[model samples]
Target: MERILFGDNQFFAVNHISDEKSRAQAIKFQNDVEIIKTLDYSIDAGVHTFMCTTHDRIATICDYIRSHPAKYEDYKIYPCMPYAHKYANAVTELGIVGTIKEYVPNNFMGSLFKGGVAIMSKDYLSIMELMIDAEMKMFRNIKTPVIFLQNVITDLLLGLGMTEVLVAFHKYIRKKYDTEAGFITMNMPKLLDLLEKAGVENPIICTSINKAGFRMSGGKELYETVLKTRKVRVIAMQVLAGGAIPPKDAIKYICSLPNIESILFGASSRGNINETVSLIHEFDKQYQYDILSNF
Candidate 1:
């Protein structure tokens, strides 16, 4: 995990703070070229890891990255899978069978068979695995060291007491793809315990970690406690608390925390990228010594 991982929320109009801002971003990044330009700024700022949803536009970005080897040689993507909206749209447009046919790779008929078995036998793990394989198809030849289970599914599985699905995702990603499985969730503490019970040791969990509780379920105090006690690699997201917290204070608080392996954020401009990266580095520089002393 990099200390800074640029995200793609801004590219997809996922402004958490304001509907007005989301609409503005939706307009600003309607062009793929604009998205690439903003990403170029992040790469130039020494942030190579793009922790992004597997949005359709990202396939274009991947195409750009794959084509520009000399420029993005160190660049990598941490794919957050099962972009819910994409699936929703596909299902609505194509219907169930058509959507399955469209997404399932290679053996369409065989995938239908598998999909049938999964649906009829309630073998959802098979469906989950199929979805993962389908989602990962666009990322071929790209370096993806970590593949995240998006928070929507992660929280749903957690709420449903579906630990096996979590375990299956963790094991399958490592076994087949040779990459780490990162689960993004709002309930970090509870998810950590669930993952540990499912035999995932020291899992990489991404969650909202900001000065304000914001979307962080189980609250910030529990998150800090889990950071101090658990052997989990946490990628902190929403550290600005959906624009509720000041950037300096948010970065300072997160940097001061015990174990945040990476910080994920998105910005539409070069200035915000530079500012946030600088704030993280400065606060990290100040607290690195203090943190090491305690260690």
Candidate 2:
């Protein structure tokens, strides 16, 4: 994980703080040029990883990345999957059978038949793998070192106690994609335990890890305990608590924790990006010096 990851929430107009801002963003980012400009800003600020959902617009961005290999050579995208809206829209417009035909990998009839068999046999793991492949089709030929299972699916499987699906995703992503699998969840403590039980130790998990207890499930204290005691790649997101927390304090509180491998945040402008990045580096340097001072 990079020390900082540029997120795509701003590109997709997902403002948790205000619907008006979300609408403004939706209009502002309607063009791919705007999205690309922000990403270029991130690259300039020395952050190369763009963690984003697999939205339909992302396909256009991928096309741009594919064309400009030299420009984005040092960059990578951590694609979070099950972009629920994409699938919903596809199903609505294409219908069930058409949706399958549209998404099933080449040899459409064979893939569809196999999918049917998996459904009839209740081989959901197979179904899951197929869905992953379909979701990843747009990311072909791109550097995706870590793939994320969106929180909606992650927490759903958690709530259902169907954590074996988590293991299946881990294994399938590793075996098929040759990359690490990451899960974004609200309940980090429970998810970590289940991942361990499923034989996925020291996996990458992204969650809200702010000081205000904004969305940190099972409480911030438990998250701190797990970070201190357990071995996992922690990518802290929503550290700003959706604009509730100040950048300096948020970065300080999170970077001071025991095991945060990366911090994820989205900002539309270069100034915001530079400010947050600088704050993180400054606090991290202070935290390191403070640690050595205690010794």
lDDT of 2 by residue, 1-295 (tens): 7899999998888998999999999999999999999999999999999999988889999999999999999889999998867666888999966675676565744755767755535655775787788889899999999999999889989999997888999999999989999999999999999999888989999999999988888788888899999999999999999899988889989889988999999999999999999999999999999999999
How many backbone collisions does model 1 have?
A: 0
TM-scores for every candidate against the unseen true structure: 0.92, 0.92
Screening candidate 2 with a backbone cut-off below 3 angstroms (N, C-alpha, C), the clashing residue pairs are none
Q: What is the C-alpha lDDT of each candidate?
A: 0.89, 0.90
RMSD of each: 2.4, 2.4
Residue ranges of candidate 2 with Cα displaced over 4 Å:
88-119
Runs in model 1 with CA error above 4 Å?
A: 89-102, 105-122, 292-295
What digit string (tens of lDDT, one per residue) describes model 1 on residues 13-98? 99887999999999999988999999999988999999889888888888888899998888899999989788778989999777
Number of the top lDDT candidate: 2
Give me candidate 2's TM-score against the actual structure: 0.92
